[model samples]
Target: MIPLRLKIETDAIEPYVVRLRSFEGISDESHHTGALDAALESASAETAEFSGATGNLRLFGVDPSEVNGDVLFVVPSRGTAHRLIRANSRHNTLLVTERCDQLCLMCSQPPKKQHIDMFPFFETALLLSQKNSTIGISGGEPTLFKSELFDFFNRAMSRRPDIDFHVLTNAQHFDRADLPILRRLDLTRILWGVPVYSSDSDVHDRIVAKPGAYDQVRRSLSLLCEAGAKIELRTVLMKPNAPGLLDLAKFVTTALPFVDSWAIMQLENIGYARQNWDTLFFDSSTGFDIVGKALDFAISRGIDTKLYNFPLCTVPTDYRAFAPSTISDWKRAYVADCADCSLRNECGGFFEWHPKVHGYERFGVA
Candidate 1:
């Protein structure tokens, strides 16, 4: 089994073998968790120690192994959640901000009015991140951070020049005023994942609960593309957007032809999605025909396409390869029957939060 990416808020990290290491081999004093040789014998959530050559470090139950790497422990808070910022780990994604400008009906992390500056946390995370890793800057909306975000990006890129960034934004904040900043940044490695719900502005705006959002997103995409930044168009499959999925695909192939890739993702049943389940949830077992049509159309047009969070058996054999294991381990789950599935290794399993309102009756051996 692959090693767990990062452990957080757990009472104990013991019994689970982990190779904790810094992005740079050198140990920094700020994250020192000294020698664990003696700490492991009586390790507990309240008190435990991990000893390294650098010094004796105190931490929860983390069983270290001879992984041939220097360890870096990031204690982001006063509490005992030691987040291992794995710069070398492929699953690393920096969640920059939880505040969003758009109130999308199906938002996984709903918008909040609280004023919180997550830059400090992000700055530390980015600095500790692995060089040459594909770093994702996501949020309720990352663009809301504006100049602060740009500064963070600038600093992070300078520290790890080989790092690539993938930012998820609604693209509502992109305009002429932001063009200068966009041009100055290292956008070569940055892939902006922007959402386009539908070609029709009204339909798109309605879904996001922002009246002029569609127009703004359209403008944002054009501006970002003009700035030579790589852009990936995303569309979340749901009831409102399903009817117009094909239309959106057509519009994307024609209007957004410059987009590097198009990702059609399954809905994560959480946050605001739970509130609007009856309205947004569509049983993919039968409703996937529409999705299939849209994917078919996009493929016919030579668009670089990806299907995310989709069950392997639900997608046609031709599109099965396109469905990668997109679900993160923290939230991914598989039904009991999946134990016998030959293609289970290749499939992206269900989200743990799935209420099973739409049963997995369609899932079977491929």
Candidate 2:
């Protein structure tokens, strides 16, 4: 697996963001501010020496090839560095906060009561992002810090209008009062990725371990539509919600017609999902009938439907086109069966922690 955080040595006493620059670009004085010259001498082959206004630092035990041109966050006290934006990666996500309102059964990143405000650092990192990149803003729920989040957006978008964001939220905190600020910002560049597991309010609330969550999401969706905000409705396929997929699709088509897209996603084996694997993991390979029918219904009604985190071989030929390689490069992995497969290059494969023993029963070549 590719590492996102690495141990480093630096003289800085406070946290700061820096974009790694090559030897040639480092000498260009215009790029000195908020940029580090990562060029190293041949004598110190293993250690990458970085220099900038912040001060000189050394990143030991890392090949320069892996992190060249990547944006890094230096936390001096922890002696660790986090890759805020990877140049080679097409998908880059900034986790805004760990605090969330609802506790979902199959949550890959479980909720935490404590939250360290990193919106300022994240705003800096977003400014240094690659041109025209769509950075994903995720969290236990980003809307928890609604005021700060909105301020960050307004400030960042004012300077960097070329960039876009795909925010993952539970849709609980949105209200009519937020409409003025939402309207002032460019909604075209923002896509809210909200979750609605089931059409039935009781079942949906039960899955999230929160009563009235479905109702809040409905209200928020209405508010977003009124503000002309773009939305991507996301549903994670699981045992509890599998049977209701078609019904939820119908609900989306009839009631939530303003949705820009609908994503039927596979469950990741991590956090709460790992603990509830047996109960929550739905093998869509064997249960593709229901999933496919739901996709068909949504697509026929003009919804841009997609399958996220699904391997190509597990999907039927007719629906394979809908399953793109949506997994991020850092955590994505492949099994031995994919070694000689013709579509290996195009497949998203699987999450690094996906169970090999009790995984899909029909995993093989497409």
TM-score of every candidate: 0.83, 0.95
What TM-score does structure 1 among the candidates reach?
Answer: 0.83
Off by over 4 Å in 1: 1-47, 51-57, 65-78, 82-84, 357-361
Candidate 1 — worst ten consecutive residues by lDDT sum?
Answer: 33-42
**lDDT of each residue in 1-366, candidate 2, tens digit only:** 888998888899998887766444244554434444344432156677777776766787777666767888999899989998998888789999999898999889998889999988888887777889888999989999999999999999988989999999999999999999999999999999999999999999999999999999999999999999999999999999999999999999999999999999999999999999999989998999999999999999999999999999989999989999998999999999889999999999999998877479888865
Error of 2 at 354 (Å): 0.8
Residues 83-144, candidate 1, lDDT per residue (tens digit)? Answer: 33443346656666778888988898887767566666566555545456786778888888
Tell me each candidate's RMSD, in Å, in order.
5.8, 2.1
Residue 235 of model 2, lDDT score: 96
